[model samples]
Target chain A: MTYINELDTPCVIIDLNKLNNNIKDMQRFASKNKVTLRPMIKTHKMPQIANMQIKNGAKGITCAKISEAEVMAKAGIKDIFIAYEIVTEDKIKRLLNLSKKVKLSVAVDSKYGVDMLNKYFKKANNNIDVLIEINTGLNRCGLNNLDEIYSLAEHIMNSSNVYIKGIFTHAGNVYGAKDKNEVNDIGKYEGNFIVKIKEYLETKGIKVDTVSTGSTPTAKISGKIKGVNEIRPGNYVFYDAIQHSLGVIDIGSCSLSVLSTVISKPTEKRAVIDAGSKSLGLDKGAHGISKVKGYGIIKKFSDITIERLSEEHGILSLKNSKIKIGDKVEIVPNHACTVVNLFDYAYLTDGEKILDIFRIEARGMVK
Target chain B: MTYINELDTPCVIIDLNKLNNNIKDMQRFASKNKVTLRPMIKTHKMPQIANMQIKNGAKGITCAKISEAEVMAKAGIKDIFIAYEIVTEDKIKRLLNLSKKVKLSVAVDSKYGVDMLNKYFKKANNNIDVLIEINTGLNRCGLNNLDEIYSLAEHIMNSSNVYIKGIFTHAGNVYGAKDKNEVNDIGKYEGNFIVKIKEYLETKGIKVDTVSTGSTPTAKISGKIKGVNEIRPGNYVFYDAIQHSLGVIDIGSCSLSVLSTVISKPTEKRAVIDAGSKSLGLDKGAHGISKVKGYGIIKKFSDITIERLSEEHGILSLKNSKIKIGDKVEIVPNHACTVVNLFDYAYLTDGEKILDIFRIEARGMVK
Candidate 1:
C-alpha cells in the first residue's frame, strides 16, 4: 500500500521482479541439471523468501546456524539443512529440539563434533542425518582430502545415532577466481572432487546419497557437472556488485540495493549519503572481485565512487558529479548477504512501487 | 546470575568492571579538563549504558541517527543530539516529534538539511536547536572552511524556527595517526579549529555556545586542549582492539569481546571459530590502526592470528596451536561500534561471571 518514495532512507529495498527472476532462473537451472535446489537462507534470512524458493521447486532450505533453522522450522518449513557444525551440549540440545520439529540435517567435519552429536542424539533416542563439510580450496573449513573425509565418514558411520547423508563443499574460492572461465573450472573441479569422494565412499561400503556443492559464483557451472546432485547457492537469491564484478550475474540481475538519500554536499566533488557501513555493510570488494572499485556501486552514476564509509556516513567521490543534497539514490552493495543482515526489515519493491516488507527473521542468529 | 562459563559461543561479552573503569576514567578526564562529557550512545546502543554515562556526569548523549535518539528518548533520556545530516520529510517530522519529548539537537552541514528542519519546526510552531558540523581534517562530512560554516550559521540565525546551538567536529583522522604524538597533534588541531571557529562566529555577531569535538583515539588529548568546551567520545565506553592498537587504551582495558567456540581444527596451523564477520564484524583494522593485525585480537593467544573471516567461520592461523574443538575463546573486534550493532543482546560480565544481558536497544536504527 505504501510507495517506495515514502519509505525511509538507508533502508534495504529488494526488487521483487529481479528477485523472482533470480529464483526462477536458479530453480530452472537446478531442474535442467537434474539436481535439487536447496537455497541457503543465510543470504536473505527471510522465511517468506525461503518459502518462495521452496515454492519455486526447491527441495528444502539451507541454514548456517541452528537458530536460523529453528526460525525456518517455526515458519512451517518442514525440511531444513543446517550447513554448519554444531558443538557443545547447549547447542546440541537446541539442535535436538529443532530436529524434533522438522527433518533437520547438519554439517560436521571432526570426530569431536560427531561424538558430541552422537551423545545428544543418543540421549534423545533419535537419529540425525549429517553432511561432512569438505573444503574445496576455500581453506576455511572442512577436510583437505578424501583420506581425511573418509576417516570422518567412517567415524560417523560407526556412531549409532548419527547417519552419514553425504558430503558438501562450499567452493567459496571461486569468489577469488581470475575470470568466468576460472570460476567454471573451479566449479568443475569441485563437482569432480565430490564425485570422486562419493565413488571412494561407495567402494568403502559407505553409501553417499548427496553431493551438495556450489557457491553463488559457481552455482551455474556446478549444477551442470555430473554427480553434483544438489546446489545450495545463497547469494544468487540476491546478486551483489561483487557477483556482477565476477561476471557471475548481470548488473540488471542485482535485486538488492540500499535506498539512500544524499544528506550532505560537503564539496563540489564529494557528497554524503545516509547509508554507511551500517546499512551497505563494510565489505570492500571482498574475495578478489575487484571490478567495482569502491565500497559500493552507485546506480546510474558510473563515475561516482562510494569511496569510503564511516559508521554512519558514506562518502562519495565523483568525477562528473551531478549528486545534490536531498537526492535519493540506490546503491548496489559489494555484498548483499551482509547488507541483508544489517537491516531489521527489507522493503520488497517492483522497481517503481513498494510491495511488502519482509522482516529478516533469522538475523543475529550467530549462536 | 550465571557463570561466564555457561554462556553461549559467538556472543558479545562485556566486562562490567572494565566498562565501569572506562566510564569513570573518561568522566574524570572530562572533569579535570573542565569540559562537558556527552558520550556517544552509538557505541553501546543501550539506554542502560547511556544512563550510566549520565549518572557519571555526562551532560547528554550523542547518536548517529534520529531513531537512536528516539530509542533513548523512549527510555526516558532527556538531552540528545543526533550527529548526522537528516534531510527527508519523514525524518524531519520524526525529529520534530522527538524534540518535543526531549532536548534534541541535530548536526547539519547543508542548507537543504536546515531548510527541511526549518519547514518541520515551523509546522510544529517550535524552535529546535542545531549544531553546524565542520570538518577539521576527517574529510567525511561537514563544512570545509570557516566561511561556509559562518554562512550556514547566519542562515540558521535568520531562520525563524531553528536556533544555532554551537559547532561540533569529529577528529576521526586521529585513528589514522602514525603514533600517539600524531594523535595528540590531531586532537590539538581539532581544538584550535574549534577555538578559531567559535571566535570568528562571535565576531560576526553569531554567538557560539558549545565547541564539542573528540573521538576515542583523541579523547585523552582533545579534552585537555584549551577552548574545547565539550567532548563527545563514543568508543571510550567499550575500548576495542583498534583503540588498543592506537595506544588509546591498554589491551586489558578492552571491555567488549566476542566469546567464541572453536568448532573445527582442520590442520595443525588452521583452526576455525564459530564467530566470523557476523559476530566479530568485518572491520579489518579500520582507520589504519593496524598494530593489532587480523580480523581481531584473540585474548591470551598472542601467537595466533585471526587470519580471515567468512560469513560464520573465522579462520585462525595458529602458531602455538593449543586451541581445540569446543574450547572457548574471546576476541576483541577491530571496531566495537559495528560489533555492538551486530548482536541483539550483549552479555554483561564481571570477567568470570555473567551479571546481566543488555539488549542493544538502538541496534539497526540506521534510518
Candidate 2:
C-alpha cells in the first residue's frame, strides 16, 4: 500500500506517457534542427529519467552542480555538461575528479572563472570542454558583450587543462514573452546572436564547438539555426502551468502533478486543500494568470485560483468551478522545477497505471 | 569540512543563546498570562529542540502535520497538538491510530472536517481531542462563524470516543503588519476575538480547557486574554529575517542562518551560491526590505541580493558592492520555518562549536 496507497500525499506523480512523449518530441526537434540535444537533468533530477531521455536520443545530460554530474557519471551518463560556473577550492577538486569518470564540460563567463578552474585541474586533466555563457537577455547570470566572447573563448583555450568548446545562453527572457510570436522572436534573436558570436569566435581561430540556447518557451517554438550545434533545454521534460500559459505546451502535456486532498469547504467559493507553500511554492504570479494560477489550478476543479496559501493550508475561492470535499485533486504547480526540489522521491505513472517510484538522487546537494 | 566548517554558508545553524532567550521569553509571557505554552514543533521539527522547550517549561509540542507530531512523539514528547485539518481515509487512520504512541490533538474548522475526524475517532479505543480552529483574520483555513463552531464542537463532544479540546487560531494576520504598532494592534484584536469566543463557549456550557491564540509578532505583544488558556507559537523558536523586519526581534536575535559557498562569479555584478530553493527556499518578499530583497539576504554580503534563483543556483548580484569567488557568505533567509523543511539534516551550533546533528525526520512527508 505504501508503494501505491501508503505513500505520502503532496508527493509528485509523473505521467510516464506524457514524459515519454516529451522525450521523443525533444528528440524529434533536435533531429529536425540538426543539433545535439543535451537535456539538462536538473529539471527531473532522476537518473532513470536521464536514462529515458538518453534512450530517446539525447546526446548527453546537462547538470547544474558537480554533485549532480557525479551522480550522472555514476549512473553511466558519461557525456555530461555542467551548465554552471564552477569555482571555489573544494568544488573544483570535485569537478576535476568528476572529469576522470565522465566527459565533463563546465560553463565559464569571466577570466576569473577560468583562472580558478585552470589552477585546480591543469595538473592531472589533459582536456575538458568549457562553454562561455553569454547574457543574450537575462541579466541574472551571464556575460553581456559581443566584444568579450573571443577573448573569453581564447582565455579558456589558453588554459593548459581546459578546451574552449562552445558558448551557451539561457533565453530566460522568453519567459517574459507576451505570446508565442514573442517567444519565436526571442528564439530567432538568441539563435542569431549565438551564430554571430560562433562566427566571430571562429574568425578569431577559437574552436566554438557547441553554440547552444534554451529556456522552456524558446525551446518549444525554436525552429533551426545554421551554426548552433547544440540545445540545452530543461523544463520541457515536464511542462507546468507556466509553460501552458506561455503557449509553450498544453496542460495535458504537463507530466508532474501534486495529489492533494480537499481539507475544508468553509465557503461556497473558497475551499481549502492540504497543499500549501510547502508543496506548491511561492513562485506564483511570475508569468500570468491562466498559465500560473493562485497556488495551483485544481486538476479536478476548474479555473480556480487557489487564492491564498499559508504554510499548511491552501484556500481555494473561484468562479466557474465545481469541486467537492474529500476529492483528491491533482495540482500543476506554477513552477514545476522548484516544487521537485522539495521532495526526495516521486511516483511516476503512465496515467492509467503507476510506473515506478524513483528517488530524486541529486535533489539537494548545495556543497 | 562540510560537517565542521568555521564558515557558515551551507546549512541552517541555530543560535543557542537566542533560542534559550526566546524560550524564556515565551515561557515568561505564557506564565504571566496564565496560558499554557505549546511551542509549535513545525518550526524546528527537531526532537532535541522540542525537548529543550519542554525542559524550559513548555506544556507540549504543537505540530502542523501528524507526521511531524509522530517524529516528536518518538522523541518522548507527550502532549501533541496537530494544528491542521486532517482529511482523506489514509489520514483518518493516522489520526485514529496515532494515540498508540502519544496524546494527539487536532485543529478543525469545517463541519465536514469535524465529521470525518469524529467518524474515524468517535468509536475508537483511544480518546482524541478536537480543537475548533477559528478564522481570526488569516482567512486561510478556519471556521468563519462563531455559531458554526458550537455546532461542530457539540457534535464532536457528544460523539462516542472523541473529546472537544477548546479552540485555536493563528494571528497570521500579523504578517501584514506595517510596524510594531500595527502588530500590537493586531495582537489586541486577536486577544479580543479569542476572549469573546472563549466566554461565549463557556456560557454555552462547553468545556473550553484550551483557548489558544498565536503567531510570533502577535504573541510578542499579546499580553493577556481573559479566557484564552494557551498560546502556540512555532516560528518564535528560530526567529527569521521576516520577524526581524516586523520589529518583533533584531537580526542579531535571529537563531537561524544558512552557511553557503560563493560557487560562481560568472559576471562582475552577479555571483551564484550552491544553495537555492533546495536548501534556502525561494520564499522571497515575505515581510519588508528583508522580505522583498530575495529568498535570503547575505549576512556578510549585504550589498548583494540573491536576486534570482534556479533550482540549484542562488544568483547573488552585487547591488552596489563586489563579491569575489571562494567567499563563504551567511544568509538570513526570508522565512526560517520553510528553510527547516528544505534539508534532510541540520547542524545545531553554539557559534563555532557543533553541539549536535539532527535529522529532519518528517521532512518531505506532505501527508
Candidate 3:
C-alpha cells in the first residue's frame, strides 16, 4: 500500500483477487470435463503463482521454452510439459539436461526436429516423452497429414531415447474467429480431429494416452472430447482483451493491468501516455474494453482508442472524458502474455491496495 | 561464426558493412554541414559500435534513457546526452551517478521537469547540463511556447545542479510528412526555431550553446539549416524498411534482418516460418515492396506476407514462392528501433560471413 503511487508509472500490476478467480474458473471447467489440467506456467513465470495453479487442482505445469521450464523446475515444479519443439542441437542439449532434472515432455512436429531430439536423448543416455504436434486447423507448426504424424510417431517410438506418449494441437486459429459460436464450433472441430487421430493411432497398435487440444479462446468452450486426457492452455492464466473479445473470459476475470500516467495533451482529441510499445506492446489491437488491449485500455475510458504507439510513448485519444496531463490511468493490456515480458517485476494488488510483488523471473529468456 | 546457425530462427542480423557505411554516410553529412554529430547510441547499444561511430567522426553519443548512458559510460564513452526526460526519482539518482562518471547532459521540456533537474543537482551535490527541448512540431514531448521555454531555462540557470546548455528539438513530425520538400521545410523550420530560441535566451542573459535537431527523415535535407550546431539521429545508424519507405536512405543501407526458416508447409498458398512478433515485430507492417499487408518484408520474395504471428510462429502466405519447410529466408523488419530491443545481442555480418558479435548492452533500462 505504501508504494502504491510511489512506484514509477508504466509498471505492471496484477490483481491477486482476480487472478485467484480466474484460476478457479479454469480448475472448475477442467474438473467438469473430467480432464487433468496442466496449467501453462508461461503466463506468470513466478514460482508462487505457478504453485497457486497446482494448489487450485492442476495436475502439472506447461511451458513454451526450455529456459522457462528450467525456471519452473528449479522453482520445484517437477511435472512440466514444454509445449514447443526443441529444434537445434544446443536447445536439445538444454532439453536433455532438463529431462534429467524433471518429468519432461516435448512437442515435435517435424522429422528433422525429432531426429535431433532422438540424437540428444541417445547422447544424454536418457529419454523424453514426445507429443506429436498436429496442424488440425492452426496452420502454424504441426503435421500436415495422418501419414506424416504416424511416421513421426513411429520414428519416435523406435528411437532409443524417445517415447511416444501423446498427440497435441493448439487451436490458435480460433483467435481470429467471428463470435462465440464460431469459436465453439472451431474448438469442437479441433476436439473431434484430436479424438479421431487418437483412434487412428490406436488402430495401428500405438497406445495413445494424452490427446491434448486447447487455446485460451477455445479451451473454455471445449468440453470433454472422447479421448482427450490432458488440457494445456497457458493464456487462460491471465486472459486479456483478445481472450475476452472471443468470449473466452469476461473482462472482470482479467487480472493484469499497466499503471500509467498521462504525460502529454498533444491536442483536444489526442493525449499521449507514458506507456507505449515498451509497455502496452504492438500485439493485436482490440475493439474496446478488453480484458486487455493491444497496448491497453484506459481503464474506464473505452472511447479512447490507442491508435498508434512508439517505443517509449503511448498515444491515447479520448472521445468523451477530459483527462489532463498528470492524471494517472490504469490500463488492461491486449495480450497479457506479451505485456508481462517487458517488466522485471509486477506489483500484486487487490484492486484497492498493493499486496505483494512477483518477479518476472522468466523475462528475456528468448533462447 | 561457429554458432551462426546454432542460434535459433528469426533472430536479428546486423550487416557490419552496411552498418559502417550508414554510420559513415551520416558522419560525412554532418562534416559537410559543419556540425557535431553526436549519434544516438540507443539505436544499437554496442560500446564497440559506439566507438566505431566516434572513429568515423562522431563528436559524442546520445542516449534515450539514463541506463543507455550508463552502459556507454561503462564502455568508456565519456561525453553523452540523455535525450529523454529523466522523470522518476530512481532515474535522477542514476543521473547523479552518471554525471560523476561521465560528462552527462539531459533534456528538459517543462518547468516542473526542469525544477526536478535543478533540485536533483542541488541535493545530489552534482552539476549537469540540460538542453531545453522545444516543440518544433513533434508534440510528443517538449515545451510548446517561448515563454514556457524561457521560464524553464531561467529555472535551470539558477538551480544548484542545473546548467542551461542550449535548445534542441526533434522534427519527428517530419516523418509524417509526404515528401522530401516537407522534410526540407521541417528541417528549416526547426533550424530557425532553435536559432530564435537561442537568441531569445541570449537576450535574457542566459547562454544557449547547443542548438541541435535531427530525425532521419529530416536529416536527409537538413544541410540547409545554418543555425544548427549538431544533429542526433538514431535510426540512420541502421536504416530500416520504414526509413526506405520515407526516402531517407536506399534499401541497400538497411543493416539488420531476421534470419528465419520455413517451419510449416501445410498448403501451397501458406508456409509458416519459425518467427513471429517475438522475432520480426508487429510494429509497422511492410514497406519498399508493393504489398503493405502486415509485419515485415520477406526479402527477395516480395509477394509473401507474414500475415499473422503468435509468440514464436510467423504465419506467412504467398501464392508464388515455393518455400520448403527447411528453406531459409530473411525479413527486413518495419521498424529497427523496436526490433533491436527484443534480443540480447546481434551477429554483425557482411552478407556472406560473420564480422563481429555485438551485444545490446542497454537492452531493457526502463527505469
Candidate 4:
C-alpha cells in the first residue's frame, strides 16, 4: 500500500471502515425486516466488495447488463440477476452459457425479450428463472397493466425452458421526492403495486415466490410494506450528495470521494483543481431532492463552490479565499456510481492508513 | 476489419471518410491563414489519431495534462504543448522527462507552477519552454492582469533553467456565443488580446515568439485577426450536437456516434435503447448556443427525443416512433470528447464498409 499523499491526484478514495459499516448496517436492516438484500454491483463493480457483501449476508447480486453478469460469474459469483431486458440473439446465447455456470435469473418486460431467452434456453436444454418487471410509477420501463403481467407469467409457465420466479419493480421515482414523507409514500406505492401484481398472478394459478422493489431513497421504508421480499439498493454502499440531500444517508456516511489538488489560484475569487468532469462525472445533484447546490461538496473548505468544469479543470469560486495553490482537498460527488466507473482503480483506506487497492474490474461492461 | 452489423451494441462508430475530411478541412484553413495548427488530443485521446493529425500537416499537438503529453511522447510525437498548468513535483518530473524526448512547452499562470518546474529543471540540468496563460474571457484558469503576466515572465526569465516561450490563451467562452457574429467577435478579441500581451512583453525586451489562441467555434475567424501565430482547435475533428448547434460544423460532418439497439418498447411513446449516460455521457449540450434540445440527436429518427438516461438505459420519447425492438440506430452525443473517453475502443467505418478500429489509448490519464 501507499500513503494518501503519495497517491496520484484526481484519484478515487474509498474509506474501508465506512464501507464495511455501510454493508453491515444494510444487512442488519434487511435481516431485522425479514427481507433478502440483493445489492446491485453497478455501484462498486469490484468483485472483492461484492464478495464482502455476500459474506456479510447479501442473498445475491443485481446487475444491469449481461456483460456485468459475465464478469461476476467469471469471478465465481454463483447467484446473479440481470435487472434488464435481453433481446438480442448474441446476448441471449451468452446469457444461456452463463446460466450453466450460475443460478441465473433475468427481468423481462416484453414478449420479444422472453421469446429470445426461451429460444436460446430451449436449444441449450436448460431452464432459467424469469421475473416480470412491473411499472410502479417510473415510466421508463416495465409492464404497467396487471393483465399483461398475468399473460406474461402464463407464457413463461407454458415455455419449456422459462419459469416464473416472481415480480420486481424499481422505485426510481423516489429520487425525485421532495422530502422524506413523499419518499415514504412512493415506497408504500411501490411495495403495494408489486404485491398487487404478484397476487393477481397467483389468482391465475401461478405461484409467485418473490416480490422485489427498492431504490436507495425507498429501501428502508419500503421493507415495512410487507410484500417486498428482496430489496436491491445500490447507492447505499457509498452514499453521495444526492443521497445526502434526499436524507437517505448523512453526509458523514459518504465513503467515496475524489482527491484533488488545487493547482492554480487564478484570482482571489477562483481556484482551479485538477479534478473535472472526467473524474467527477457531470452530474448536477438530484432531480427533486433539496437543492444541494454546486457539482459537489468540498470536504474541507465549505465556503468554496465548484462553479464550473471543463474536461480536466474544475473551477472553484472562493469566498474569503481560504485555499492556496498545491493544497489538496477531497470532494464528495453528487453520484458515486458514475464516479466509480470513471476510475481504473480506487484507494482503499481506513481513515489514516491505506489498506489496499480496489480494481474496478467490471467497468465499461455496458453492453 | 469487421462489418458494422457484426460489432457489439452500445459501441462507438467513427466514419473514416468524415474524419479525414474534417482533418483536411482544419489543416487547409490553418494553412490558408498562415497559422500553425496544434489540435488538442483531448478530443480523441488516441495515439493513432494524433499521428494522423501530424501526418496531415499539423505543426504539433496540444494536450490538457502532463500524462497526455507523456502518452503522445511515447508514441514518438516530437512537438507537444500541454495547454494546462503542471504544479506537483511528481507531474513536473514527468514533464521534464517528457521534455527530454520531445520539444515540450507547458502553460503556467502561477508562481507556484513555474517555481516547481524551475526547481525540477534546475536539478536535472535542463531548460523547458514556459508559456504564460492569459484569461481572454473564459473566467477559468488564467491570469487576468498584465502586471501579473509581466511579473511571472520576469520570474521565469530570472530562473536558471526556465525560459519564456510565448503567451497563450483559450477562448473557451466562445462556446457560449449566441450567433456567428459573437463567435467572430470573441475570436478577434482572443487574437488581439494575446498580441497586446506579446507587444507589452516585447517592450520589456522579453521577445515573446508565440501568441497562440483558438477554440473550435473561433478557429475559423480567429486567424485573420493578425499576430496570432498558432491555433489550437479540438472538437472540430468529430463535431457533436453542441458544435452543430453553435454552427461550427454541419450535422453531416459529425463522424462519431454511438450505435445502439432498441431493446424494449414499453409504451407507444417510450422506447428503451442500450446506450445510456455510461456510453453517451451526461452532457446537456453546449454552453449558450441555440438549444438543440435533448440528450442527443438520433441520426435517423429526427422526431425522437432522448428524454433521459440511467446507468445503462436510454429512454426515448418518440413521436409516432417507427422504431421497434432490435432496430439499430446511431446517436450523436451532445459532447464528443467525454463520449470518446467512455469507450475503450471505437469502430472505424466508411459509409457502407468497415475500415478499422481505433483504441482510445490515453483515456483516464487524468493525472
For residue A315, give model 3's deviation from the true position in Å: 2.2
State residue A11's C-alpha deviation in candidate 2, in Å: 2.4
**Candidate 3 local lDDT, B228-331, one digit each (tens):** 88998888878777777666667777888888877566567877776767666666622111323466777889888888777767778777887776677888
Give candidate 2's error at residue B354 in angstroms. 4.1
How well is each residue in A243-299 modelled by candidate 2, as lDDT tens digits? 887888878889899877778787777788888888887665332123455666567
Per-residue CA lDDT of model 1 for A1-367, tens digit only, reads 4877777888889999999999999999999889999999999999999999999999999999888888899999999999999989999999899888898899999999999999989989998999999888888778967788889999998999999988999898887887889988999888888888889989999999989998888877878888889999999888998988888877889999988999888888898888888888777555423466788888889899888888888889978878898888888999999898898999999897998899999988888
Docking class of 1: medium
Give me the candidate number with maximum lDDT.
1
Sliding window of 10 residues with minimal summed lDDT for model 4 chain B: B284-293
Q: Give Cα distance to truth, residue A11, candidate 1, Å.
A: 0.4
Clashes of 3: 6
DockQ computed for model 2 against the true two-chain complex using alpha carbons: 0.56
Taking the tens digit of each residue's C-alpha lDDT, what string does model 4 give over B120-179?
A: 999999999989999999988888688898999999888888888898899888888877
Q: lDDT tens digits, residues A1-367, model 4? A: 4778777799999999889999999999999999999999999999999999999999999999899899998888889999998889888888889988999999888888888888888988887898988888877779978777778788888788888899899988887877888888999999888888877877889999989988888888777788779999988889998888777878899999999999899888899999888988777643222356777889968888888878888889998967998888889998898888888899999875778998998988899
Reference-based lDDT, residue A345, model 1: 90
Candidate 4's C-alpha lDDT? Answer: 0.87
Residue pair clashes in candidate 2 = A1-A6, B8-B259, B9-B259, B9-B260, B10-B259, B10-B260
Pairs that clash in candidate 1 = none
lDDT values of the candidates?
0.88, 0.77, 0.76, 0.87
